[model samples]
Target chain A: MIIDPSIIIIEGLKKIIESGPEFKITRFYQSNSITTNVLLHGIDILLVNPRMSKTSQFTKFIHDCRTENENMVIFALQTSYVPMQMMNLVDGVIEMDDDPSVIISKLRNVSCKTESANLSDNCELSSREKEVLVLVAKGKTNKEIAELLNLSVYTVIAHRKNITAKTNIKSVSGLTIYALLNNLISQTEMN
Target chain B: MNKFTGRNKFIELLNYNPQLILMLPRFGMKLGFGEKRVEDICEMNNVSSFMFLLLCNVYSFDDYMPTENEIKDIDANALVKYLIASHDYYLNHRLKHIEKHIGKIAKEAGKIGDVLLNFFKEYESEIATHFKTEEDTIFPYLLSENKQMIPENIDLDTLSRSHGNIGDKLSDLTNIIIKYLPAEIMPNERIGVWFDIIQLSKDLDKHTIVEEKILMPYIEGVKGGSL
Candidate 1:
């Protein structure tokens, strides 16, 4: 989504985005006020020249965009610089004179990050795995966990493999921190 | 990653994954192999190629798993020797090396630095204790000659739990350094410590899996292959 008032800037941005398979043109709104009425559910990113409109209005516009689709990434368009205040309002800034490669790479990075975050969000542990994870974090081996849970050792192993797959955390240290960070174990349980 | 065979050159292993350099010292392997094949080098070092490749696969490939035959053929003595060497290298070499570098940065950062240093010290001691448990109890029981150690707290069920305690501490140390440390305090030094921590964490994790997947099953003498 491009929200610049200038025709040349929009075309240039369009060329930049289309240069890669990573980004696409969603919808363009030359006027910031019009976007408030527009449905933004499907828009993944917004490339807007918030400077075209008043700073105060850009804030409100962005706030409205957030309510409509909070997952959407916003990149403030800048010629030389976007004010530090406005820079805080978006995920990144795209200078008008930025190399096309630079612009694409920045968007690509943000896109990959958003996707991985969604993956983590979807990776919910089953209660049994959570039980296994807390024990594993506490320092229990598979045999002990199996004995404690009254399951076969193989069953415990399967659960561990599943836990690793879902979380994509392969290391014991990684999983332990995962459990700790997720509050499955307390700070005192860190031993 | 393709499974490495005895035909693969020893130096080629490094080319395949440079991080295997860390794995080498554990197996008592040192640099200076110009063009020796894997089996040749293994034979020279008295290291089993089967065990070498299995460890290599684990270290190099993220999703590598040994076949049942591979598991059965694993040289237990060689594996244990490698693991014990790995622990020594980690404790005496890598951890101390990182501590030296991190201590310098920690002192510069003042109070927060002391806290970080102490946090690291706790982790270091915890790792020493963790490895000591295996070295003193588990290894003794596994390598028992008179079969006396098995009857005295010889059960190794607690092995998995201890592995994570140290691993998690290393990771938490990383998180604290990366997330909470003031950016004003040397960024390069912070990154230096951060990289070493991540690398060591990864190396430690690899070490854990070798014990868990290969050694644990081997220890149980479990006839059925699972996990």
Candidate 2:
């Protein structure tokens, strides 16, 4: 069976979309008719938030087009409290406030398990270790980390050990540089 | 309070003296202090306390801080306890837990997120020490009426040193989260983790506030002197 393209979200919501799923995503500008037409024909999912700056008529047109086709799953984004009745219009509503990871999980739950299958192999970093690495990347030394969390230096070193063991990047400086490159820490973090 | 993002105020304070982060080791070297002092500096700089203890106990980063022979010479259990309680229990657990569920989910999603899981492995011990430090040290000191019952070991000067390191940890962690997880549009759960991390850091800040605003004053009042 052919796997469908993961998502086609409206442009302004791209950050939310990007942060949500670790999958391939295409975006459509609010006014781009050809992009909308192509998205309707292709992607497996369409995520839109009505509160976008797009005109109501354009929004209506996109809605009409999406309603006519059932192949693509349409999700209307809402804040935490939209009326329950309005949710029936789309495949579902993803709360604007929902965790991006949660959204991805929900999408994966509905779609397929293929994406989750390979992630473990890609990084091999644990959640806490990743957190530590990200901080190391940002250039926080061991003592600073310890104090901020009310810990001693020894524990922070253990995390560094774990980070190095998993990532195969040995030095703290190297880890910091790596994190910065990976978008794990910002440049200003060196401060 | 403009949506309190979870940066450590100490690190933010250090940002004013960006050079302090670098001066740590040099100072450690200059003082000719033991592994504990170096570890304290590292702790003050936001290095992972969990990892630091492991390294000291395991003698991993032997080249930089205390030589293996030097650490071997010390009272091993006391040093180990110092490493574990001060670093792992106090710092790493809190910082890592601050990450909350979204970070957990992101870790699960990212496949490389074993850090989140490892934190669970060390959670109980870390939290125990954290609470113990406050309850055993600060609380009794603050609540004490009779001078004899109060422990001199839990003084503000000592806590302030710890606060310095913890503050640094907060700053570094905040910097990492802000860089990796930009605040554009995150899923609510991921946002929750960010918020949790922030809140936990804020809790530390509040703890410090208690030390500075409330606890310290009482201690001072009782002592009839300045901290």
Candidate 3:
């Protein structure tokens, strides 16, 4: 998504980012008010104006999207000055003056590998993915898992997606049972 | 590359994808479609050929979405009746078929099987609520004498949003059987149930696409004064 008050800038960003197969403009909002449909598409990367992305109001909306797929990446589509505190919310900034290549590269850099668009036939979960899986199985929210692992929430989400791709497990109950069966977590450890 | 129009023969359509046979009874179609074209069968069954083909497109091709104009031509009553039949088929026939097999599989597998069954039961009730919401609320709005009245509780957006997780659990169930189920416990019966789960998942997904992409858009268009 490219959330900009200016339609012209959104078009420019769409043209630049869509040049690469890595990014496709899924949704754009001229006004800061985004409908709940943002979560519906399982949107992976969000390029929103820094002003709206950091608003105390939109933060909750962004957080609500995490429930769908925690692996979502949000970037600031920078068109003006951004405070450091505001910068904290985004994965990276796509500066307004940057060339199209520069913008696409910045977007692609943060985008995780869609390793299995279709679930992998033989998904071998990484050790970190296993850690995330155990946390997930225990019914820990992504934020809690992120803190426990001493990792960014974004990275934890990426791990979570990879775990799903590998194990084909989705629901917490199923993952918990998976943990129990695989001995990743004992029965007593699960909440 | 194209949709199955009235010109297509029934035998050829079945040959194209035999799984489409599942859609027959839902549309009030029956066996022995010999030498009959799509239109002929629809006429014989008192079904709308366009609606039948529209639904066939939905079931057969993921990329096929009817335009608002195309959807406007459909009889909303026929569409509702089709959806209601689909719900009945799901909750009564398809679900019962799986439950019978899984019931035996659950008995043989013990604790894990019991846990899986309970999860499935939870999913079943959610689906019941989901469909019942449509049947009790949305269906009446379409079929009611008063066309101007907005449904009291359920809206199209809410109906679409609520469709979220009923299908998710099916994936979880299939994965649990395939990836996590102890291989030792009733492997043959387990695999049999797995097949049923997958078939139901795929059908339910198409059912959702019909509701979200076609049905909701039609009603939204109606509200926008195109009806």
User: What DockQ, on C-alphas, does every prediction get?
Assistant: 0.02, 0.01, 0.28
Sort by DockQ, best first: what order? 3, 1, 2
Fraction of native Cα contacts reproduced by each candidate: 0.00, 0.00, 0.49
Compare candidates 1 and 2 on lDDT and give the better one. Answer: 1
Worst 10 residues of 3 chain A by lDDT: A33-42
> Mind giving the per-residue lDDT tens digits that candidate 3 earns over A54-104?
466556666665665566677777778778776776677888799888877
Chain B TM-score of predicted candidate 1 relative to the true chain B: 0.88
Q: Which stretches of candidate 3 lie over 4 Å from their true place?
A: A1-165, A184-191
What is candidate 1's local distance difference test score? 0.74
Q: Each model's TM-score?
A: 0.53, 0.30, 0.69
Residues forming the 10-long window of minimal summed lDDT in candidate 1 chain A? A32-41
> Which candidate has the top score in lDDT?
3
- Candidate that would win on TM-score: 3
Candidate 1's residue-wise lDDT over A162-183, tens digit each? 6765775655655665676566
Candidate 3: fraction of native contacts reproduced: 0.49
Model 2, residue B196: C-alpha shift (Å): 3.5
Q: Can you tell me which runs of candidate 2 are displaced by over 4 Å?
A: A1-191, B1-103, B109-111, B116-128, B141-145, B148-150, B181-188, B225-227
